[model samples]
Target chain A: MLAAGLLALSAGSSAATDGYAAIDGGTFRSVLPAGPGIEQVDVAPFRLAKTPVTNAQFLAFVQKHPQWRRDRVAGLFADQSYLQSWANPVVPGAGAPADAPVVQVSWFAASAYCESVEARLPTWYEWEYAAAADETRTDARSDPAFRARMLSWYARTADTPAAVGKGPVNAYGVFDLHALVWEWVSDFNALMVSTDSRDQGEDPDLLKFCGAGAITMQDKENYAVLMRIAMLSSLQGAYTTANLGFRCARDGDEP
Target chain B: MRSIRRLLRAMAASCLAVTFSVTAQDLPDDSVYQLQVPLRTQADTASTLDRWRGHPVLVSMFYASCGYVCPLLIRSTQKLDRDLDAAVRRNLRVILVSFDPDHDTPEVLAALSAKHGIDDTRWMLARAEAGDVRKLAAVLGIQYRKLPDGGFNHATIISLLGPDGRVLATTSNPSHPEAEFVAALRATAVASKTPAAP
Candidate 1:
């Protein structure tokens, strides 16, 4: 019995789901608004990619050539080629590590990959929970220093994206959420503070969107944040880039 | 029983929306409007496009009605803004060219910025005519279509324009965290003489 138990323990370690680094923070409990769209997403403690997706991982998606990849036939501009380039498979000769996060993938490509793996991309709130990695402990939402440091990587020589945990993952099992490639969230289009579509009579369904975790109490504060989410949401799967990447998530049991 | 039925209905609806939100490729890119505008920008207003000479520009296209993707586009631009220092911020500016020409006026943009408190002074929201909007979209290989309900079925193309206004990097979804814009900006900055004004 002891021998069998030991063997099982070792196997569990090998298959252990690593990636969650729960931040040392609070139980920010709140209720979702009672509306048609808002719903509670009890994101049980989970793990996420601490860093942005990488070129190597994206290369693999290119081989798969999922529906997201649009072709770059000559003379015609490659529409969002970066997202699909990996989906397009550059040399096919290039070898990629399966464990590496996929970069240059649009929210569509990333979402599809997560679905293929029997998972899903995280909500913007969940991504933040992981990215904040417990930094929700601090009250520095407007720290200019933090924002500056996040962007500092752009000025450096990113010959190869540094390995995960090169610096650190936050409280959540996620690492490099702040400094590496921009990550794609499941509700990557959902913005917290404001909505531009509501201003223009684009659709009566303007406020009625899919993938909202909550009917947020207040509008989001920054167009900057709205802009980021918009960019992520607008992309097709065929896109990829040196800096764009994505992480994965599984809907954990309700917390 | 009625409450349970309502719950089930909401669940079904949420699933359907999530399905389309996560899985669909049908978002508008408006490639139909290819290169029809003069492709002017706020940068052009402050100085000649020649200031950067051959530097590259990262451009974001959006309309006011798009409560969903438009915010994402702005967020992506903000992400690019987040990566820049004050000096680089000065050299690299994210262009927000309004597509909801019917709604996104200069005053509207200024109000939105004031409302949202978007910081990067380098980020400018340009107001233009719908025809010019189509032309600019064409030149940069961006796509957008006016929706039947007045919403747009638009291409979410964010391009890195060479300072000479040559298109450099065209990012798909041009709205996410803007990794393409960030990378293209860095690459363009390195590849330019003066680099465009902040």
Candidate 2:
């Protein structure tokens, strides 16, 4: 009970300030292949939201942009389950705590929200680079304890996600990147093209893809990140799920 | 002879322009035309995605420099066009939007159109800004990524949109057109002409 009270207090303070953290992005080795013969990806420095957008923030967004409201949104941009957890169109109510991260939002709806704030959804490379850090080290992906903790989170299923900012902050001072929810990246659809089809001379799926080659996983042991890629690739732009949410990123240092 | 051909193309373009302006306001919520993306055609004319709104549109994305599957995409689309009834074919429009907008200028697109022998009246090679291109690809469920070598790894799926810009069908295997997709195209084209028939 004391921990819950402390969390609520921290959440309220952070919600009032809702700032961004500057990430000095450099070349990072990713699990997903960047391109043909490309292993390491160069991500430009950007500002990422310190925490996921919460229910209270999203509710305010819908109130201002009526076109993005659940009842008024175009069918092409959101599915039937968009914001379904909310008590009503304008209220988050009990089932959705205002401090908890907002889920059940389609990629288009998330993109629109970020655009409203003068930001955009982070690209896959940017998201991965930011998430690779831990509380102490810039790149804790090589640490066995860190990998194990992330894998355990993937194994456990929670009925409701805890409030944002309750988890440990990474080296970049970002929170809830792993233990909270899967995020919607801007280029989610571009992640899973099969690169092996290029060498397989008679590959039947050749017509389905064009140009240089397909993508191959560079780091197979990073199953947690690989799972995120698999999940994102399987989803369409208009799809919404209970455990999927997003955060915003800016192009340069001007957070 | 060249002047006559240019005049015919101009006449067709004007007709399409009139049709688009008339129906621009009442687009359905699910219509792909709801996306306000500006396009530049191979003929150097400014256009939008809804330029051929009242006609059945065969839409796909490709880069002009692709040596292998992109060419097959055009050939397959041409083959599909050949198989359609002449009445349905007349009302069908094909727009292949380029993924590499920086390199695919009007001159490059025009050269590609000439190489493919594409009819300017019914076929258009268009390019949009990089951001708009991504949005279009997302709507059509097409996937593409730019390689370091300047070539794009992209999906070769061809989507058939009805008169209202709703995706009626999509076929990934463009080399051998799916029978169901062909039938859907025929039905949509015939149905679109029904309200206008006397």
Instruction: Please tell me which predicted candidate would have the highest lDDT against the true structure.
Output: 2
Q: DockQ for each candidate? A: 0.02, 0.28
lDDT of 2 at A90: 86
B126-195, model 1: which lDDT tens digit per residue?
A: 6676534543554454544443245655556666666555565666643342465567666655666664
lDDT tens readout by residue for model 1, A71-109:
321111223444443323454223323334445454545
B21-96 in candidate 2: lDDT tens per residue? 1123356667888676789999999998889988999999999999988888888789889887777888899999
lDDT of 1 at A179: 62
Residue A22 local lDDT, model 1: 37
TM-score, chain A only, candidate 1, equals 0.56
Please report, in order, the local distance difference test score of every candidate based on alpha carbons. 0.48, 0.82
Candidate 2: lDDT of A171?
89
Winning candidate number (TM-score): 2
Clashes of 2: 2
DockQ of 1: 0.02
